[model samples]
Target chain A: MESKRIEQLLNKYLNAETTIQEETILSKYFTGLEIAPHLEEYRALFLYYAQSKTEYSTQSIQLKTKKQHWKWISAVASFVLLISVYAGYLYDQNKQAEYAFEHTQDAFQLLSKNLNRGTNAVMYLENYKTATGKVFKELN
Target chain B: MNQAEFLSVVMPFKDKVFRMAKRLLVSIEEAEDATQELYLKLWKNRKKINSYKSIEAFAMTMTKNYCFDRLKSKQASNLSLVHNNYREKGLSLDSKTEISDSVSIVHELITKLPEQQQLIIQMRDIEQYEYEEISEILEIKPTAVRVALSRARKTVREQLIKQHNYGIKEN
Candidate 1:
């Protein structure tokens, strides 16, 4: 295609007016080793598109390394958090059990004191009843 | 998406992802970091992504935003490193002779453009994304995408011509 036509197409391309097929044509045109001198500046831009695809770099390895480091750090942090929460829960349960045990012991002690007082009172009443019976027999 | 599905779709696009990062951030190291970060983000939110149409665009958008955030942070710190690094390595092509150095030059020039223009070039030329997809990715009207791309192309073309003329004069 003539340079003028190509320039027109390039203009259209810049305007986003070209179709995918037109883009392919432009890509092919620019890929040639020999481009017109005036249009040579655009050669790099189009050629880059035509020939350039993605390629992995050593930087990607670095990225992976950093990622792995962060992943481990995050995992460790989460594990510690879980452990801390579980320990807190266990501590709370133990405290509740201790309080319940102390309350039960206090209740038992109170019950024992009441039983001892009742036994003493019963003994005293029995002795008084025996005296009263002896006095009634004498009066008779 | 499941992890495996996400991996299958995104793994192939790593280089593209990296290139976009590199183009936007102007640093290989930072670009690699961005790519990994982008992937991790996508993995974390895999369930929210419903279709491929939005997936690629969303990834690109994430990359753009991430780069922008980095840029802003760098600026806030008053760190001269980012712009200095760009100046030092402006238009430096990789060691692949199969691709012309001019491509790198164009890429460098593209980096100097505003964020919107740079993104349009990335999607339309480099990624071969459709106009509608570019529009969606940018959240701009399709017509706006076309106009921005056209303007960006003209700018790059002018810079290339200037450089070419300088080269010819020196020779």
Candidate 2:
């Protein structure tokens, strides 16, 4: 009776009308130890299908790197670019500040030198006037 | 989806993609290359991958198309597949060779079949995909999938029975 049911299922299987469940049942029957002799050739056929499912390529897929790497590279590049631009701007401002400081120093030195010279001249003039007044008083 | 979700969804079926490619391509090397190539392309469009209802089916279809393109290119250069030369390793040589021989015979017979039937058998029988699933992958009607699959099985069965009875391998 079971064989009769399997035979009917096999017919449907060969016609491709059986459900996947029926096909699975047929596969199990054929792959089992006791395949019907008349259906022996069909055994290899089902066996082949089972064997083929495990026939995957040994090559590993390493798609993790390439596109993701490019994204990281571009992000790093822009980051470096941003840092360099900001650094250059900071350097320029520092240079301008240093130049302004040196210019102010030079201007102060020039003013001090002129003022010292004027003070020296005024001291000499006062000395000359004092000496002339002493001589006139002695003559009177 | 994002990378984690994408990998979880796709990596499980990555071998299935490779197997599908192997079915279409000539050698293991070609199939591996095709699988990697298909995955890379999928990665590039991974952002839109979630839009697909069944990413596994989509990837299978992509693998099929990519491999066929490679096949066509090979054909354009006047090259053809040399079937029946593949060796299954790691088996103790003497005992299983006879069975493997039978298996190889069936494999050659499959390759000799017309393209549509070959793919139909691969999808329906070997991959154990549902008829509706095979129809979706192959872009044919469900009834048409059954018809083509039946015809392919019959061809295999006839040749296999002939081999058993006559002990002669014939195309």
Candidate 3:
């Protein structure tokens, strides 16, 4: 009589019509040692299901908490700030060097132009001296 | 929600997520990684986490989709939907010795099942989810879930019986 009931429950179970309670009953019936020989094949299936349920993940979950997130964000932010600051310093240094170079070039150009003017005055004085010598020679 | 509250709400189903991932993924490490990834995603989106009707169902669906994508991706070339993690926990040496072979055979047969069928079996038989919950996770109608589950159960039953008979014949 118990076997007959289990057969009906198993049929319902196979058809996906069994309620959770009835399925539990079927599982219980299958797990027992006195299951009929014909129904014995299903023992492995039910046992496997029960065993599968027990198989929890052995690994622990590691969530990056908000504090950690902030830690990382701040770390990255500081690194970026450091890089940009160093880059700007390098750029400013370069610009200062460039400015000094241009001013030096202008000063040199001005000095050379003034020196050329003095040379021109000296050349004019030489010409005047030669002309004076020729006039004095003429007078002699 | 705060991280603590979010974790309190979501951590209850972490094992379920891992188990479902293990169902779809090949290795325990892969499943663990997938679980962690899913949780990280949920944690990132925690501001909107409470907007969902059921976070557990959402997580399961995400796990299923993530695992399927992983399986289809290029790295999944070496990965197969093999249920090799059927462990024998807390059982006596005698019973473990008896059921180990049959349990492994059932594990092999489960892996041989079709993709949808395998999910249905895992969700229904192993995980003991209701039809509506299974439908929600798999995004199928309850009727379709029932039909697929029935088909999967019948297939496993047929294959398992055949294997059992074959073993008897060999003995």
Question: lDDT: which candidate is best?
Answer: 3
**What tens-digit string does per-residue lDDT give for candidate 2 at B121-147?**
887787778877888887889999989
lDDT (0-100) at residue B138 of candidate 2? 79
What candidate 2 gets wrong by more than 4 Å, as runs, is A64-140, B80-99, B168-171
Task: Give the DockQ-based CAPRI class for model 1.
Answer: acceptable
CA lDDT scores, all candidates in order: 0.77, 0.80, 0.84
Candidate 2, chain B, TM-score (2 decimals): 0.85
Model 3, A75-120: lDDT tens digits are 9999999999999999999999999999999999999999999999
What is the model-wide C-alpha lDDT for candidate 3? 0.84
Worst 10 residues of 1 chain B by lDDT: B90-99
Of 1 and 2, the candidate ranking higher by lDDT: 2
Pairs clashing within candidate 3: none
Worst 10 residues of 3 chain B by lDDT: B85-94
lDDT tens string, model 2, A52-140? Answer: 78766677777676877999999999999999999999999999999999999999999999998999999999999999999999999
Candidate 1 residue A41 Cα shift, in angstroms, is 3.1
The collision pairs in model 1 are none
Q: List TM-score (chain A only) for every prediction.
A: 0.49, 0.52, 0.58
| Residue B93 shift from truth in candidate 1, angstroms | 5.4
Best candidate, DockQ = 3
List DockQ for all candidates: 0.29, 0.47, 0.62
